[model samples]
Target: MMNKHTQVIRIIMIATLQLFALRNTFSQATAQRPNIIYMMSDDHAYQAISAYGYGLNQTPNIDKLAEQGVLFKRAYVTNSICGPSRAVMLTGKFSHVNGFTDNHSTFDGNQQTVAKLLHNSGYTTAVIGKWHLVSDPQGFDYWNVHPGQGDYYNPDFIENGIRKRVEGYSTNLVTDFAIKWLDQRDKSKPFFLIYQQKAPHRNWMPEPKYYHLFDSVQFPVPANFFDDYSTRTSAAREQEMEIARHMTDTYDLKLAFDLPKESQRGLNSLWTSIYNRLTPEEKQKWEEAYKPSNDAFYKAHLSGKELAIWKYQRYMKDYMRCVQSVDDNVGRLMDYLKANGLDKNTIIIYTSDQGFFLGEHGWFDKRWMYEESFRTPLIVKWPGVTNKKVVTESMVQNVDFAETILEMAGLPIPTDMQGKSFVPLLKGKQKGNVHDALYYHFYENQEHKVAKHIGIRTDRYKLICFYEKNEWELYDLQKDKSEMHNVYNDPAYGKVQAEMKQKLLELKKQYKDPVPEIIP
Candidate 1:
């Protein structure tokens, strides 16, 4: 017979063993799974964010993510246009490889996507807003997207198969829908949610409530806000996206009217209708207290040079207003995550469809190989996974996002993806550098009149060759971050330029770029 002390010890040992076995099984089941929340803003610029040090605008929520995680100093898009960049991001390939080189180019829904891969690997995936790829969004279990650009108010959302017009601010409505989906989704499984916002895109119009948020302050002008595009190449000289020239009074951005003309009456009516829809106290304050000096200029009958300056001021003001609203919505989302206890487990990313030229090259829209339009802001926050307050100067491309997502979840990268994972860098592995160099190709021959160009950006310099113009422009980024001066033809930098050209040629061959005969 066993002694009483021995029997008690044996009972305790059995209970402990059973508990260990249950814990091991639970950990195994939960391992290799994480929740992903990818958020993208439309036409947002790297310079606009306070974290990037432009300091013209404030983005506290986005900056908070950077404070808590890693901030990528040099993040680029495959193509500098909305549609193609988005497609490249989804497919983890270049614009040429994905067959979406322009706004008009349609995306084949059958293509392999990060969403599909995540779904197949036992994750529930959903895309909430702005699917501009011109295809029925594939790989997502649920999708609610803007028709195109979308409306500031009373926007139409194509959810599943039905096109329903939702009456609310685009940003708020999109977020509400996203939160609803989060609330209703299967709690037992991991989820991948893409919350894309259409706010701050072209013709930056904000909701009535957000319109006057930044009215009291005068936004500072960019140092190169009045760039002449003189020292740059011929391609820069030929572009038509100038803030002083191309901004119109009618289309997307319209200012207040002093004395409504017959033509202005229609716009006035719309503004009044929008204003009247607001609460009585809100409308009273907007009409009586809020008076924009821009209205007086718009009401003036000026011609030639005076009119051009007036338009630039109006454009800048309205554009910043749109951005202000976007910043607010970003704050709202961050607050939701923190309040719900999802902040710690979730990884949040913020970026744009592509970089926008905020009058940097005297340009408004993107689709150029220039640095302002090519580079975008990328911020990632993963609690306990990424070190706090880290800034990685390594070159990272938008295409790499897909592979990085897979790697974060411990999933195998697809063979078709051209991008490599940067998860190791986030985890403090620091393999010297993330990329030796980055490649950029923009094939969209669009409204800007910029020709097809393929370029390479090394740590120190950028080399771009305009295929149609038969021209080359080089910039030494180490010395010239503004890219105000071109040194392609300078004899002093001849050796550096020549080496970059050869590297470009080698990359073209490696990436199978279809452009024939890289002109030296």
Candidate 2:
């Protein structure tokens, strides 16, 4: 009954209204979601990264993230070990709460995890690479993790109840798997990806291809490479992980040595067998690296102490060479993200299972609450959300990582989580402090002989009490950054130590830590 032009006008108006409604819905959905990517490295340290002022190594990609976002200077782990730290990061709970107090304690997959929370909130969650926790990983839509520490070459990955041994270096393979998963993920929703790398860890064995890469340079030993462990607590006196004396030759570590004629023949045979397993190119590179060190050892007629120093230098050089490969791979990941246009949207994070001693305090591995072992490297990049080139001196615990991720994702934090959200600190809105003090507990009485110790670290002081020994150690971090002096016995700092001890008590009660002994 109506004219054709009138009917056409009515149809156009209806279409316009529908389009407006659709636009409003889409904007609301997009505003609620933000993509997150968390990348962690094994045994990576703040002191080793060039952005944190390590002169010997260059990590341009890691530094690039720092250039674009916030670099946290005082990031500390709850327990400075592999399994416990990872558990804390995933659950936002302390080791005792999560029941992962040591490497021996198995993680209960039934417990709530960040991945589970994010996935339940409609985010695609994936974890690719080194999962040291004892239980099977839960809450991930797709999971591919290394079996135990994993191998530098030909690592095995457990994928969906199937363990498949894959060839290629662990770092490259992990990255490849992560990228493949990313490509296949549903693009309509936001994602949470954990790309963990097993590199520069203990025994310090690099891929054969990277052996000759740093051969031209001699990496200097740490300034405190020969610490005497004097003027400190008794715990410092018991560690047996020295880089020079403890490294085994069976692990392909570079060592300068001389022995009896018969022993020399045996050594030659061992080296020959190890070399035979390598490709021709690898053999060539190994020979080039060993030749000069061998010549120097024979030419010097070294004895006793001088011989030990030579071995230390060789070990240090090889360790740094392994780290060189890790740095290169970091650059590779950053490059991939930038090339794919995901770098701007993704929140890049870099850290480690725990910090390791690079010849500091004459220690090699980590299990202690010492600064070198407890402090980890933490860098975050969130494009256009935070300012560039800013350093936050606020205290951050590894347990807070889970809550921070949830906060950034706009999800309600679980009530069981003991950590506070650090999202406000990252956004540059929280001015006062993220945490007034951080609590630490390590129950793994491992080879390091480090006793079960619980402590609290404030901005100015550290108070630690060894439970079994019933002893305490205090240090003023503002004055003694290296923790070279223990002031627990000093009468002058009695009041200060008492205050810190009280604070430690308060934290223990708040967190419901089981081993609570009020410091007198």
**RMSD of each candidate relative to the true structure:** 5.9, 5.1
Angstrom error of the Cα, residue 431, model 1: value is 4.9
List candidate 2 stretches off by more than 4 Å: 1-32, 252-288, 291-305, 516-519
- Please, what is the whole-model Cα lDDT of each candidate in the order they appear? 0.79, 0.79
Worst 10 residues of 2 by lDDT: 252-261
Could you estimate the TM-score for every candidate? 0.87, 0.88
lDDT of model number 1: 0.79
lDDT of 2 by residue, 1-520 (tens): 8799999999999999999999888756754577788888888767778888868677777788899878888899998988888999999999989988888888999988999999987888899998999678899989999988877666789997689988677778888888888889887778899888887776566766666655566666666777777877667776557766665554535443233446445435454443444556655665676778677777898865566566666655666666777777777777777787776677777788778777676567787777988889988888777648888888888988999999888889988899989888888888656889989998967665677899989888898888777878898888988888889979999899879988888889899997756445
lDDT of 1 by residue, 251-271 (tens): 534544233455445445555
Q: How close is candidate 1 to the true structure, as a TM-score?
A: 0.87
Most accurate candidate by TM-score: 2
| Clashes (N, CA, C under 3 Å) per candidate | 0, 0
